[model samples]
Target: MKKEYKIGLSIIGLLLLVFTFTDMNISNAVYNPESKFGLIFEAIGEFPSAIIATFCTVSLMLTREKDKSIKYNLGTVGYIVLLIFFSLMASMIPVKYLHGPKALIPILMAIYITVSYVIAKKCATTHKEELRRAAIVGILTFIFVIIAFNSIKFLWGRERYRHMIEVGSFAGHSMWFIPQGFASGNEFMSFPSGHSANAAIMAWITLIPTFVTSLKDKKSWFIRFAILWTLLVPVSRIVVGAHFASDVTMGVTITLVIFTLLKNKYINNLEEKDAIHMFI
Candidate 1:
């Protein structure tokens, strides 16, 4: 691991330790249901995931082609389909909160696709193998983070701070360590903040150094951005009473761990076979 990563992990460990004890207190102090800033963040929290999914999809599709003619093999097509599905699902998470015209969703998606295609094409043409590997690592990281956090959220079934506030009591509140398994609805899926987990996926920006040689020396900048975005989203979640400190911390931890492992296995380790290629 890099020295930066070591330092980053240490910070995360300290946060998890500190937040575990102060989770409820932090939420109680910061909870503001009507805060516009919190509402805005909550609405667009999934945008990072959508962008990552689109970028990976475009990268994989362009890099896998033999030529510019765009002939896609069955495996490539299947992967593209799956990535598009993930992208759409993520992008739609904020639609209900947008309170805008219905056309806004498609417009934003079009923009994502256009920008992703241009960037992916450039990388594909110049750094074919590197881009393909990065795309695979990114896609796997996104999928695994989603699955891990959501599964834990469902099984843990802790109530959201906001929901408790709405009901006028914390009597039903459960600690982060407790499993209240399979309760009523979305309110119960609060042990790990899905918004925080999804926001942490922005850390995928750090992987650009692995494929884009020009930005290799500037990796620390990207790392700082990732760290900033990750921390900011969790703060937003807490401010809006959507999650406690521990829930946000655990959510960020899930993505960071999964991303680090997959990045090491597929991007850093040259001898390792691509997981998708092994079967496809």
Candidate 2:
């Protein structure tokens, strides 16, 4: 895993260098905002990320309790599943009915907390630790991904696809070579697509819990789903006027590196400590 991480980081760094040198020429080929293909891909791309987030949340809420009897644990899991089912059903209601898509966030948060608390309070009353860890993992996955993406965006400024000369923006398509202060503010803030990075992070989050679990079949399915989602999210951002192809690619690549490192260092450490306690 470490070797793979090193190799992946190296390849992404090389791509960053190459793209920085040829940003304008590369972006010019596919910067058309009016293309039907681009519009269609952009429209559907966001759905995968949402799906991944839901999967992560559900996985976190349904964690297995090490000390509980199988029969009792199964009952608790069934209850959690019902909670998730209702939450998902609520999500399907029209966003406007919830006030707006953005408004649904707080609603979902309330639902997650309420459901998690109820599950811990009643269903798995004796296994609160497991429930708390699950919630922590899900919430931490989201928080970490957002923090990582925004941190880089604030520091590394690159222009968006539509901000190029070809797209009618006065800001010349300065490649990734230009930092924020060196170029127009609009042109210098687009190196990595925040959307693409977020998607990658969510995909990884779905996989983190699987690392120490014996659920091979479930893990395989999630891996396939994450791979498909990771690919789609980047394509969607690029097809739209939001990000250049390289910008999306690099965003996912860098995010994967960050996610992997953090998971190994922190998540794996916790798992190891838990394993030791089990033996002791």
Q: Which candidate is the best by lDDT?
A: 1
lDDT of 2 by residue, 162-240 (tens): 7655567745455554555433464455766766776675555354334434444577677787777787767666655
Clashing pairs in 1: none
User: What is each predicted model's overall lDDT from 0 to 1?
Assistant: 0.83, 0.59
- Model 1: ten consecutive residues of lowest lDDT: 65-74
Tens-place lDDT per residue, model 1, 1-280, is: 6899899789978887887788888988988988888998888887777688778978887876564444446676787687667666655766767776666677767777888889998887788888888898888888898889888887888999989889999898766788997756998888798889989998888889767989999999999988888888889999999899989989988988898888788776773555556777
Quote the positional error of residue 89 for candidate 2 in Å: 17
How do the predictions measure up, each by TM-score? 0.87, 0.63
Model 1: how far residue 119 lies from native, Å: 1.3
